[model samples]
Target: MFQKILIANRGEIALRILRAAKELGIATVAVHSTADAEAMHVKLADESVCIGPPAARDSYLNIPALLTACEITGADAIHPGYGFLSENARFADILAEHKIAFIGPKADHIRIMGDKIEAKRTAKALGIPCVPGSEGGITDDEEALQVAEKIGYPVLVKAASGGGGRGMKVARTKADLSDALAMARTEAKAAFGDDAVYLEKYLEKPRHIEIQVLGDGKGNAIHLGERDCSIQRRHQKLWEEGPSPALDDRQREDIGEIVAAAMRKLGYIGVGTVEFLYENGQFFFIEMNTRIQVEHPVTEMITGIDLVNEQIKIAAGLPLTIQQSDVRLSGHAIECRVNAENPENFRPSPGRISYYHPPGGLGVRVDSAVYQGYLIPPNYDSLVGKLVVHGRTRSEALMRLRRALDEFVIDGIETTLPLFRVLVRNADMQNGDYDIHWLEHFLADGGMSAQ
Candidate 1:
């Protein structure tokens, strides 16, 4: 096991890694930007270092400074708790050159899976189901039109290097395809410095489900289970739950085995997620996240597995202690992301929090880095905290989440708490008949009426 590890990120996830390291008797070093000089993770870590200014390019995303911090602190491994450089293949290679373990997958695996075009190819080669689209990136509008016609209408044009819904456009007609392609290419070039874009058949109202897989360096891998992240806004997940409500027992086992086999075949290690879009009784691969997800706590709550500890152990040349059969899903879990934003306009509301209280009870967990009197800076993500609750069934979990949201309080700033309160009471959500467009429609239709 590594004696020390450096966390290369910020916010609640950074704090989460620190706590996990402490439990495993591993020292933690936190890297923060000038904006986060007094962040909660910095206070809890055994050591803290200032990397750069508030801008992500100079701070959290700066790879050289992170490597230097590791050298200065004598840390043997670096744990990127999502976002920033967590999925950067170059960063992984740099750590490998320095003989410092990158507590994730190999650089080659990252490189292969980071590009949407290559990931699709790899998934197809592994016999994993994928959405029908162009064989590779489209070189021009003509090729895009041809591919769109072949794939049928309602196709999506996506940047090869995109995530977070950036550089993506949906075209439902031939006339829209050319314009969408041009715009997506421009956005991809500006955002990712790559003009490459690919076309894929888009499934309207699909349920966004993902399987969590853990692997050892020795080619052994198993899936913890699946999470239904269909509750989202503009491609950002809002509410997530374990043992996806959409999957039957046979479907779950089938997808789980395929995902585990793909990971093992690719020599993937540590923790990762294989995302898919399910609609019309079929599943299609979307992309793979090379690090822990924000909604991972829901999976942990149901499985009772410490994913962070497992990542560290895998990096230290230890095989996974648990097998597929050993993994068991006990109950339904839900996570609602509470962000510091206006519930009406959905704009960032950064200010000093005058009053703060997190709900707590049996099977309720709160992951946050803010407190009363703490000023939410405008230089970072608007997320203030996450309220996660677990129960014996989905309906029971919904009831618990409603109660927990009512108990949560934050003053001096508008938040999405009200939004969740309204969501939990919606009939579509209550019956599990909601689709990806449900939230957008609900919000656009002036929200739900008072019951």
Candidate 2:
């Protein structure tokens, strides 16, 4: 076991890793930006260091500063809690050169899975279902257009190095393909510094389901089941739940097997997610996230696993302590991303939180970093907290989530709580018949327009 670990990120995830390490008797060193010097994670960590200015590029994404912090603090390992440099293969390699363990997948696996084009090829090689599209990266607009035509009328142009909904464009006709392709490439180049783009047959109204897989270094891997993340806006997940309401037992087993096989084939280790798009009762591989997901708490709630601790243990050369049969989904769980933004216009509202009151009860858990009088900086993501709940059934979980959302209150900044309240009460959401476009259409049709 590592005596000390440096957390290379901030917000609730940093605090989450800190708590897990503390339980395992591991000291934690938190590295934060100048704006987050007084953040909760910094206060809770055994040691804290300021990396750089408020901008993420100069701090959280700064490899030299992070390595320096790890060296000075004598951290045996570094835990990047989602986002920033968590999935960065170069960072992993740098840590390995320094003899510091990166608490995630192997550097090679990260490199392979980080590229969408390579990931699709990998899935195909492993016999996993992947969307029909271009065999690999399309080098030019003509190549993109040709691929789009072969894939049929509706095609999606995506960045080879993209995630989080950026660098993507959907074209419904041949006339739209060239422009969409150019736009996608430009966005990808600007966002990831890679001008590569690929094409895939677009599946309209597909449910975004992902399987959470954990592996030990010895090539053994198992999945904890799936999370239905169809509730999203602009490619960002809003609410996620376990044991997808749309999938049957057979479907679940099939998808889980495919994900596990892929991970094992790649020699993947630690915590990761294999995302898929399910449409017309068929599942197609999309991409893999090489780090802990924001909605991971829902999986833990149902499976009774501490993913963070497992990540650290795996990095420390510990084999997986649990087996596939040992993992069982006991109940339904849901997580609502509480962001400090206007529920109406969806604009970020950053300011001091005059009051912070979190809901608590049986089956309800709140993962947050804010306290009363805490000032939310305008420099980063507007997410302030997450409200997660579990229950014996989907209906029970929904009701519990509704009640919890009502109880959550954060003053002096706009939040999505009001929007969530309206969402849970909608007919489609209540019936569990909602698709990826449900939220967008709902909001466009005056769901949040009223207030």
Candidate 3:
């Protein structure tokens, strides 16, 4: 195990890494932007350093500052929790040059899986199914139109290097294809610095599912089951659950094993998620997240494994302790992303939180960095926390989520608490009958109005 680890991110995820490292007898160093000086993670770390100013480019995303902090603090490893530079392949290579381990997948894997087009090819080569579309990068409008027609209507034009629902556009008819293709490429270039885009047949009403896998980069890997993340808004997942209501036991075993096998074949390292679009009893590979996911807590609730702990250990050359047969889903788990935004308009709500009281009870957990008087800086993502709940059954989990949402209190700001409160009682949500586009349509149609 590493003697010391530096968390190269902020907010709840940084705190999440800090606690896991501490539990494993590893010292932690917290690096923060100027705006996050009073963050809970900074307060709890063994030592904290101010990396840069409030701007992410000058702060958390600054490579030199992060490495300098590790150099000064003698942290041998850096854990990039989720966003920022977590999935950046170049950042991983830089850590290697400094002899500091990046507690995630290898740089090569990150680069390969980062590109959506290449990821689909890899999945197809590994015998994992992929959505039918263009062969590779489509630059010719005529060729794109041909692929679109062959794949049928409602095709999705996606960025080869896209993520977070950016750099993607949908065209329901042939007339909408050319503009969608051009716009997707433009957005992809601006967002990811890559102008390449591809096409795929858009499957209507598919549940977004992802399989979590941990690998040692030494021919050993294990799958920790799956998470249903179909409840989304503008392609961003809002609520996630484990042991998808859409899948059966046989479906789970088949897909989980296939994911583990693919990881072993690819020599994948650390923690990663193999995302898929499941529809009509078929699982089609979408993309792979080369780092820990925000909804990981839901998987942790079902399985008694600490994913962060395993991620750290694997990066240090330790093999997995659990096997395929050892992994088991105990119960139902749910995670609602609590963002600092208006529940109705979804506009950002960043300011001083005057009063903060999180819900507490059996099977309720909130991973957050906010306090009664903490001033929420507006320079970063709108997310302020995550509410994770577990229950013996899916029905019980819904009940617990409802009660917990009612008890959660935060003043001086608008939160998605009201949205979650409304969603918990939603018949469709309760029945687990929602697709990726369901939330947006629901919100637009007064689902978020009076609530």
Query: On residues 196-283, what C-alpha lDDT tens digit does candidate 2 reach at each position?
Result: 9889999988999999999986889999999999999999999898889999989998899888977787778999998899999999
lDDT of 1 by residue, 1-451 (tens): 9999999988889988999999999999999999898789998899999999999999899988998999899999999889888999999998999999998998988998999999999999987899999999999888888888888999999999968888899999999998999899899899999989999998988999899999996879999889999988899999888878778888999999999999888888999999999998788999999999999999999999989889888989998889899998999999999999998678999999999999999989999988888888899889898999999999899999999999999999999999899889888888888778878887778883432
Q: For model 2, state the Cα shift of residue 178 in Å.
A: 1.1
List runs of model 1 lying over 4 Å from the truth: 448-451
The alpha-carbon deviation from the true structure for residue 425 of candidate 2, after best TM-score superposition, in angstroms, is: 0.9
How close is every model to the real structure, measured as TM-score?
0.98, 0.98, 0.99
Q: Give the per-residue lDDT digits (tens) of candidate 3, residues 116-204.
A: 88889998988787888888999789999999989999999999995988989999999999899889988989998999999999998
Cα misplacement distance, residue 144 of candidate 3 (Å): 0.3
TM-score quality measure for candidate 1: 0.98
Give per-residue lDDT, candidate 2, residue 154: 94
Rank the candidate models, highest TM-score first. 3, 2, 1
Error of 2 at 14 (Å): 0.3
Task: Assess candidate 2 and give its TM-score to the true structure.
Answer: 0.98
lDDT of 2 at 413: 90
Q: Count clashing residue pairs per candidate.
A: 0, 0, 0
